[model samples]
Target chain A: MIRPANIPRLLLTPAILTTVVTLGVCLVVLLVLSFGRQNYLDIELGLSAHNFELALTKPLILKLMGKSALIATGVTALSLILAYPIAYLIAFDIHKNKLLWLILFTLPCWISYLLRILSWKLILGYQGVVNSSLMGLGLVDQPIDALLYNSNSVVIALTHAWAPFAILPIYVSLEKIDRALMKASGDLGDPPYRTFLRVVLPLSLPGVSAAFVLIFIPTFGDYVTPHLLGGPTGFMVGNFIAMQFGASNNWPLGAAVALVSMLTATLLVCLFIAGSKRAVRAIG
Target chain B: MKNGLERWLVEELECGRIDRRRLLKMMGAAGVGMAATTWSASALAENNLTILSWSGYDIPEMAPAYFDAHPAPDFTLMGSDEEGFQKVHAGFRPDLGHHTSFIVGKYRDAGLLKPIDRSRLTHIDDFFPELEQIVTTDGKLWEAPLSWGNSSVIYRRDQVEVTDSSWGLLWDERYKGRIASRDSLEGLLIVGGLYTGAADPWEMTDAELEKAKDALIAQKPLLRFYWSSQTDLEQAFANGEIVAAYGWNASVAMLRKQGIDMALMKCKEGIVTWTDGLVMMSGGSASDDLAYEFINAYMSPEVGAFLINSYGYGSGNAKAYESVTDDRLAELGITDPDVVISTSKFQREISAETRQRYQAVFDEVKLS
Candidate 1:
């Protein structure tokens, strides 16, 4: 097996080269398009960052970015809180038919994304199941309104959508922990709880960090769930950035805002990477 | 392992040779993929008029009836106005589009739409003169009116007190927990402006916008929920959880038929109504004849009835109302939509800066 390391590298070269070329082409195109003036009447090439300057001043764009950041942070924190315990159980307690538990966790994610979000609309609408159930139970004299729209609805919808993303990474990271470490801790003076707090918790930071990054990026860019659930007030940064490219017809600003969002996401990823680096060093 | 000479050559290439080979294959495969996609896409894109519309615009139930009728245009519901236009710009062309009255000029300026022939539309004359005036730009018709409805306070009379002046009631703290609003930027701002006595709601400057924003943001704690869907909003009203909110006539009419005590009235400073119209797409592969046929199909009274019944909206086809049973017509808000529609004004298309201020101020209002 150790005969030659280049053997695997040689075999993987075609796939690796293909991916690099494909990504290279996309980045080159984005670079070219970034400078072109958007004349809906005609497409052409040019040099410009006038789009960037004007885009920054738009109030709506700024507001949306704020919303996006807020929503992403909230969704990540909420998802981690919900997914952590489930992931911990699967990684430690469930040994037999573990694959079945993985499938069960993943099954809901396999269902249509839009379908799941829209289901909340039905459940929370004026004639929704929640209100109907409440009425049937005679909890109130009249139907309590204001249950669906605004920030509350947005959080509930995003948290539901983000759970699977938060769970899988954590489970993987925890699963990869050495079994001997836990057994050794048990053989030594420490009990199961202390071993988990001291070993399992510290070791699983990489997965938790990975989970946050995964949930954060998509939710930050997600405008649909917030729009349908958040209504106008709950509109996020993604929705705002979308408008610049959309009805607003201000592409430079869209790009700038997109870049800003990208930078924010990059920042988060870098922080996670640095944190993981530190975690690894500390663990060693 | 096969051959030492071949292995030496393979390593000598440093994969640049393979890189070139894959490049050629990818280019060829990509070309083939494009050709295959076009082969299939052309088949799919043909007769497939990717319609830019509202969520309920293309009811799946009516696809068969549409395909049977003077067929061509396929209506695809869009999530929002901004998203629909983005798709149109992004190579997904539609034969025609539906938009609020405000943006028709902007579409024309962007060269995204074609000027329409008023004569070809059978219902052009049937349209309220006020609406007709709005659709015309410097004597050239851009969009044909599709539907127009007034925004009114929709409350179930069974659960809440009905009033002639409803604008004050939306702000009335008595019904605080039970009340709801449409949760629109411009629409909610309009309410806030009126509440503060703005002469024209849309004309608010920055300071005024902030004022309106503050008013709306303050009202948030009072609302059960702000909503976007007419169907869902009606469902809310039907269940009596939503004592009232900004509702179009058609939805209120439909709710009334369900024996819900729904009523619509002109609140002080009066009601704001919108006119939705059809814009023909320009420079698409669509033949002139196909476009004309599609327009004619929409002109049909039968299709008009379908829109009115299911959507709770009106069509411009003058005779479309005749297809509705007299009882149904009166029940569905089409009997004389002209009255409310005739009095209301169209939403004006503003510049991007103004819109930003509008949205910012609108955002500020809801946050307040």
Candidate 2:
């Protein structure tokens, strides 16, 4: 038997030690770097808020952040709607081979994300599968130019990439709900739709919120999806941050951008959690 | 090629399974020891030279003689000059880096380079006069001039009708949403600056920068997408998604080999002429002597011939011309050196401030 004091120390050792050494120390270094001046290969180490000033006041950066947030929110919402029905079927309708359906649904996640995005580019290109078939069938004179390389394509690719994540959590929540509640509602003469709205949805709020966060945070900082599919219009704040590290060679500016974007994401997530908890309370 | 087997033998000897004499006898039976000894006159010849270069520059065919003479060097291929610059600036130095001429001024100024001793490079004098000038900054040689090419509008001839071969073809309303441009800051700005009639595409004034920005913004809606890789542009052109785009000669040659009817436009406005060369970083993994050996091997006529035969890029060594046929030269668009040189405008070194401003303007245009 372990003492309670020793138990706390044992739990804290691995998690806290690793977190402090890896993230905490790196954050300190990044904080220092973000305030210094980068003069080509030489860093002056003079404390300055110039990087923040440059990054924050740029209208382009502001616009990219707003666009990124909006797209992330859109992806999360779409993933939820698309994933809900699949989760519902797996939880309630599917009796035999539920694991097989779940496995098949999440199978695309096994492939590399880059390869997946590239496949989307191929399938949606002007001379891609859909366009070639349509043109072959005499549906149109020329290849459809709007199939890929736009904001819509970015959202589509992101939604596809994150749908599996959305499905699993909602499925778990639905699986946990008691069948007795549904019977009780039916016994009380409540319609199936009303029972679903009042009982099923309320019980599944936690999973929906989990799915929302799982999709939103990653999509918000996604550089690859936008870069491959979004074209110029799809460029987000992450691309801006990447630019600072790459072509700019200004680590300070890149770190500043990262820190600011992280704070914004944190704030958004906090608000989302609080609002969702309230929504759950109201629904209950 | 003997480097791998020799390393295994050395490891075997170190493991005490075989004595040095026995190891040598086993290697003699395999006929590898004599080859290794004959290749390196000194046993202390650098074990490995790390070469950081663009994709095509690091191939075996490009440096066959060097591999034969010394141990095979490790190659880290980067996609862009900016990537190479960042890597070197961040203190990851390789024996030699293949960087474009435009970055030399900035990188040299930043103290990222070591001045090459031209005396060690036997083939330095054999380089073209234009290339010779590119490597020399303030009479101090900093880079080994290797290959040259142009960045121009490569169009699908079967899809689009060309009235005038000009940079304005990109801005033409007919090819709107079907044309592509490079997703690069300096290259696009140079094109835009030239289109807007700036005195110099590089080193644009504040007014010229604004004009360039407006010009790029106007052309953005017309673009299918800004391509960052030659493969992306090639795929786009191959599929007939984009009718025209600014691309390098290598991509044009690559697509043509695949039966894609691609043609590079001889724009009335000058094209972006660039030369890529090997610059030795100050803090390299290999010794200075070993680095120079690789550099000299790279500058030799054999490597030059390989580059021309394989990639269609003009070799820096003028002797490389003697190896290439007249028809191949014409096809590669360098039949007349004087005409090509006079018609093209080389990308010059821009200050970091100007580069940042150009990048900002480009980002704004791209996002807007």
Candidate 3:
């Protein structure tokens, strides 16, 4: 009665059930809560779109959402630009001790995320390493006040925090590419750059897209980085959502803002995937 | 009994006398037995008192007498009063909870709190009458006053020259990009109202709210960052990253300890004062006797002295001042509690609608 194929299905049953029970149930609860009304500290559950309407129409919320998306996109673009080179190096050039190279590259991930972010604060603070070094070298008479506590500082910290996550996927896809394709392109009289552009880069699009989505989604909802480094102007949608749940005591609005952010991020990610697919096809 | 059984199972597993699976099974059986015992002994609910408090307030020093009478109560730390209030409103059944006076009305209105009997508090006479008055409504006391403090502009005296000790020093152009404001709705809006000369900072009109919002937006550029924690503000001051900031009494005492020459300004407008205390939950599983014992222990002069001397906060117990030295009191800037209270404006309770408007203005300023 117990076949091997059925055994695999049975083995997968727990994971499937877990996903449904946890993620699926949570999403449904959040959806319901988003439409409810906030009565003092308690949420009066009912059918209403007032929260969503305010989330969408409020100038402050809309502006913060836009700013969060822009910051996330900038972080994604920067991570890709920075990660691709390192990933390419590890995939193609580091034939000796490739595992060692990989471990070295991801060594920062071993530290706590909070510690890593705090270290960036130390490196970028007014009396931080960068400013001290600059001032010591006579690069400037005053410490650069703009070095920390802004959107750029937030972008820098996030790009560092998610570097390993971005690098690994791109590296995996690059490693999976067949060397013969590059040889074929070169054999057909294509230059090295052409081979890289047409064959290698297009083929590695999956990893690149994976890396993009991985960083973009979390970065969009990042509260700590922006809260710590993103001075006054760097407050994001996540902070706004947190304020609603905390000081504002408006769970319905917080839920609605959160759902709206998720939907907007999903739409952008879809558009990105579609655009990347087009680029891949055109290049190939 | 549970601990003994668990230790025995661990030892047996380590000596290879029992497999891990068998040890786990035995442990599970022991846990079930423990649960059964707890359920059967539910009449002795005082033994199961649960306390929800701010992080450091749950230490044994805060309630020595209670500890002597019973085992350590279950302690759950909350980061803020808002967080604690939300947890209780969402059906958390802790016997005792900590909250600020400003939010006590909200808790009372929500029917989450029980009226505290004054006759039950042994240390009631030691408490400042002014503070007790703040937490009382309709001749019923709702919370036992614990710690009180002032929120004011703290500045590095050597680094910045101030002609006037006013809240305007926070928005001074001379300290451009070298100042920090509090990242709090109540703190920020109150600062805005006071600076803009609103009649009542806590109950500003629509136009007053707008004026405060505009004033905050203009001051945003001059801020290095809005500090949410006392530690961050202290670190910034220590590093010379900021010369002025809106801070609490703890920061003033802390920075002075580090030899930062920090001064807590006696602002011309008024300093913001706040008090936080312990309240009994209405439907808590624990017995009222246990809750009263814990509140009394926390309010004792010894515990009050510990709070003031250790944390640089004003203890609600007036007699606690006798234990603290006059010099230490001066260093903490609470030389006379009556004078401080008279000169300072209390952060009072506001309606939900007013709170929303204030929050909106604060959020709008931050986002802008």
**Residues B1-368, model 3: lDDT tens digits:** 55345344334533343443354456568776565455435534434677777767878998999888887877776655665666666556677888888888888888888999999989888777888888988999999998898888989999999999899998899999999988777778889999999999889999999999999999988999987666788899998999999887778777888998988888889888899889998866568988898899899999888888877889988888898999988877777977776666787888777887887787788866
Name model 2 segments beyond 4 Å from true: A1-8, A44-47, A276-284, B1-45
Top DockQ: which candidate number?
A: 3
**Candidates sorted by DockQ, descending order?**
3, 2, 1
lDDT of all predictions, in order shown? 0.68, 0.81, 0.84
Tens-place lDDT per residue, model 3, A155-269, is 9999888878889999999999999988999999999998998999988999999998999999999998988889988889999988777677788888999999999999999
Which run of 10 residues does model 1 chain B get worst, by summed lDDT? B12-21
List TM-score per model, in order: 0.75, 0.88, 0.89
For each predicted model, how many residue pairs clash, with residues at least 3 apart or on different chains?
A: 15, 0, 0
Comparing 1 and 2 on lDDT, the stronger one: 2
User: Individual DockQ of the candidates?
Assistant: 0.24, 0.46, 0.62
Off by over 4 Å in 1: A1-95, A119-161, A164-180, A183-188, A231-233, A269-284, B1-69, B79-83, B118-128, B162-164, B177-196, B202-210, B223-226, B293-342, B346-368
State the lDDT of candidate 2 residue by residue for B29-71, as single tens digits: 8989896456543433545676777766666677777778775
Q: Per-residue alpha-carbon lDDT of model 1 for A23-71, expressed as tens digits?
A: 7675566556556666543445678865555446656566666667777
Query: Which RMSD values do the candidates have, in order?
Result: 9.3, 7.2, 5.7
